[model samples]
Target chain A: MTSAPVYLVDDDEAVRSAFSLLLGTYGISIETFGDPAAFLARAPKLKPGVLVLDLRMPAITGLQLHERLAAIGCDWPTIICTGHGDVHACRRAFKAGVVDFLTKPIDEQVLVEALQQACAALDMRAERAEAAHLVAQLTEREREVLDMVGRGWSTREIAESLHLSPRTVDTHRANIAQKLGTTSVAEFARLALIGKAP
Target chain B: MIAAPSFEPASPRMPRRLAFLRSSAALAGGWLLLVAAFGLYAAETHRRALEQEVSESGRALQRAISQRVAQHDAHLTSLSALGLAQAQPSADFDLVARSILRFYPRIVAIDLVRLGPGGGVVSSARAAGGTTADPAAVSAAVKNLAAGRAVYGADARPGHYRLMKRMNDTMAVSLDIDGRGLVEEDELPGWARLDLSSAEGPLLEIGARQAVPPFAARTVEFAAPIASETQPLRLSLHRTVTLSQLVPPLPLALFAALSLAALVLVRSLLAHRREAALARAAAEAASRREALRQHETKLAHALRVNSMGEMASGIAHELTQPLTALLSQSQAGRRIAATGGLAGSPVDEVLAANVLQAKRAADILVRLRAYVGKSAGEAGMHDLRTSVSDIAALSRIDLGRRGIALDLDLPEAPVAARVDPVEIEQVIHNLIRNAADAVEETGRGDGRVVVTLTRAAEGAVITVGDNGAGIPPDILPRLFEPFFSGKPEGMGLGLSLCESIVERFDGGISAENGPSGGALFTVRLPAAGAIDEAKEAVQ
Candidate 1:
């Protein structure tokens, strides 16, 4: 797995400096922007990264920056950090797809944990894409058998539900397992759920 | 957080109108009182002067009539002397009688008679062209004469009289007189009547008898003995008169009336002048108050700026980003330093960031100072709770030093209002300072000031309560009166300025003692958004 840098966009230079220093000790590469416009100017070249955002700032707020980033196809996992957060700010943060809403002065452990979760989510996205690619190779009949198996149905129950012979259902499930490269029903269910997700 | 309080200016029209009515009524009432008093005095003086004049005139008339009657008696006495010398009816005796009658016309008749044994008049001598005495009256007179005494008699006609005198031991004389000849009827004033009589009966009147009017009349009576020894006949005169005829003439009465009228006019003019002066004074006072109010507003704005300048560092807390960043950076630097520190760029970068945040905070202060320095800017709608909290932050340190704890109770809903933010803050700051001072003065066990903001139909209500010495009863009514102070060092402008500010915003302020023994001040202001809502409804 490739390491990705954590991007920090905040008007407060000291907050960016302190968080960068702290995360550096945790072995994370960090990049800082004093303004959202400056970050947006370089957004096209950004790789997948966890973004630590300040809710309140002059020119453009963190939530507004998030929307601008998303408009430019740069939807990074965002963590919001601010001195205060009212109901309106909290509602706006969630609406902007913030990974975590953190109020400053931020706790070191919590920041670490939230970053770890975001990294885990990125890893999961990579795995889901890989799984989706593998599942795309299955035939229609094989895919039906995989869906039933993902529902925890027996091969015979899958045959009855699809009005097919049990032996034929068994053959379709084997072929799905071959194409998906996962004989485990749990793995199959995850791939099927990912495919089913909107 | 210091809550924003409502500030509505008071309208002076109602109080001024009431004051005008009261003063006008008082002025008019005083004018009427003076008129009544003067009228009574004038009337009393007129009555006294008229009474005196009438009384004097009546006495003078009576005296004149009496003197003339006495003169007739003197003539009668000379005739009696002549009768005593002559013995019988002779030409000489008749000559004496005629001569007396010619000299005194009031003596209508004179006669000499000799008494018989039965006291009858046996012989007599008479004067012509004179009133005749009755023979019966002469007989009666003789009877009395025979007893060695003179007698007087009066007939039914007014001013008619008879007198009998003993000339000697065997002789007597009779005289008949008309009293009317003593006085001319025209001599009396129009209002007066005079009567002359003897003890015997009614004699005569100079004028027709007059009926007394309902009001008072002046009367004089006089009596004089007609003859000395021969006859004890009395001459009496009475005079009755009314004051109108006898009052001092028309010019004098008119002068008195005119003087009274002039006095009333002068009094009314003076009253009008005094009322106008009072009204002018009231107007000047109101004008002065308005000027003072403008001055207070300017001073309040200046004071808010001064306070903000003084609390520069504290206000910097409002820029949380810089402070939070500085605090976190410094903490991170210390943490890094504890681990033997970082190499060149990392350590240098943290220090640079700290400097940058400090500079940013300074910039924030500059911006805030500029904001606070403005005076009489256009009013803007502001959140009530937030404004109040900002004021509370400014006063927190001062209260802390005095060991007074300020607790704010703000409603969840936003109380929006329109006002100059700095001016409103100054009003709140002053109120909080007053609360702190009161708490310090009381020196109670615990010092606490609770500030509460509530929304009402009329507007927003802000109440500040202190657990300290309550407002003194005598000073409570004048709590917001300019220049009225209970404290030795107090300028007493704080609450007054607050009231002026609040009233300017179409609000009201009041002070009272809380039920639990503390001072309470309430400020009410019209809600800003409510007006827009009403306008929208109307539209």
Candidate 2:
């Protein structure tokens, strides 16, 4: 698995650099931007990373940036960090797909945990995309066979359930492994669990 | 030395008090006039009534006197008839005189005389008592005898009179009547009288001799002929009626006294009403002023608290940046030191930067405390320049947020004044905030507020001027009045409270249009040294 850097966007240079240093001590890489405008200018080149945004800035607010990003279909995972959070602002952050909203002088443990959670959620989304692609390649009989095998059923049981011969079920299983590029049963079970586009 | 005239404003209650006094005086005067008029009318009415009663009594007395005299005349006529029909003896005449005198109290004597050949009286009635007949009397008797008539006269004595009738050409009969008895019959208590007149001017006068003024005493006169038809003897009765007889004096005096007392009562009642109204108005004014004072205090406190809240948030924002910087630098430096990859200069630099940022955060907290923290507010000498600078520093964050520039024009030397430092700072802060608001309202770019402190004869003057559209003409008068606001969000007590605080320090505050444009507010406070000197002089 590849780890991505966290992007920190804030109007205050001190806050941006401080957050970069704080997060860097925990072995997390950070990219700092002085304002939402500068961050947006570099947004296209950004890889899948967590966005740590300050709620208030000079040109535009963090929430407004989130709205812009949503309008542009930039669905990067987000963690909102700010000095103040009224209920309205918190609601807007959640609506903007933020994983966590933290107020400053932030607790280091809480920030690290929120980052880990955001990155994990991003990883899960990427895994779900891969699983759906692999599942789309399978034939209908291959899908039924994969589902049954992932359930820890025997080949004969899978064949009876599908009303097919055991030999046919084995061939379908082999074809599913080749199509998914994973011959490991554990990998197949993982794919079968999240392969329904959820 | 020529001195300018100082005009002191009249008190508000003056006109009403004056009007009350005028009306009260007029009412009192009118009351006295009414009493006097009624008293005069009562006295006149009483006197007239008394005069009418006295006149009636006088007429009745005249009738009684005539009746008594007529009875005496009848006796005299009988004596004359006996003398004329047959020569009567002296004893017969004497008997008749005694009988006449007994019958008429008015008559005291009677006489019979003979006029021999020449109408000379040869009279014998108790020897005539040396009352000789005059030749005129003899001729009058002969003339009366020729006419067959009787005569009466009053020239005999002080209170006596005589009546006679011709018995024949040779004789006549006579009687002398006392007039004093007539006075007794007619005289009443509290009244005077005069009796009949004969040859004498007046037969009798009774009562006091001194004349009474006409209106003060009521007089009645009655005149009636008495006795014989040939004698024009008249009974005259004079009755002078005094006021005490006509009307009792006590009730009239009581009525006058009561009227005067009632006048006093009505006047005092009106005066009391006026006083009560004045007192009520004064109390209402005082109460209204007190309520206004309370409302102003509440609004000022609320504005101060709310602004402090907003400043606190700004402080959080302001301090957070430095805190964040300090945290990040120290953390970065620590990580580098733990890794053994820290270059000496770089690590030291980061730590130094961290220290600097931490100090910056601390400085922000101190400023925040100075701006919003409560203090003992002990009045003492304060450096005006320092207060202005402190307020300027406190207001910088708000000015920056609003994109306004604050210009300070304070003197290099300290301007010392006597005031509570916090309160004075707050007043300056309020003025700055108002200036910023005025600038903000203009919506002009690069809004500027200039704060200047200067020394004046009376005190130190702190002026806050803003480059904005000047205050409107209509609201200028009410600018320092409580609850008068130009902004929709303004509590409007800022300037009013500032004025009050300044005045509490023996100072004043005023606003005016700057020579250029915009609004300028000036606060004046007494110099601390000058106040001390004044105190010393008073001591």
What residue runs in model 1 are displaced by over 4 Å at the alpha carbon? A1-198, B1-77, B88-91, B117-137, B146-148, B156-158, B184-187, B210-539
Shift in Å, residue B28, candidate 1:
12
Evaluated with lDDT, which candidate comes out highest? 2
Tens-place lDDT per residue, model 1, B322-440, is: 56666555645655665674535677667657656655654555565445334334568888887677666556656877778889888888888887766677777777888888899
Report lDDT (Cα) of residue B159, candidate 2: 62
For candidate 2 chain B, the 10 contiguous residues with the lowest summed lDDT are: B1-10
Tens-place lDDT per residue, model 2, B97-145, is: 6665565556655556665545444444432232544546645645645
After TM-score superposition, the amount by which residue B86's alpha carbon in candidate 2 deviates from its true location, in angstroms, is 9.7
Error at B94, model 1, angstroms: 3.0
lDDT of 2: 0.70
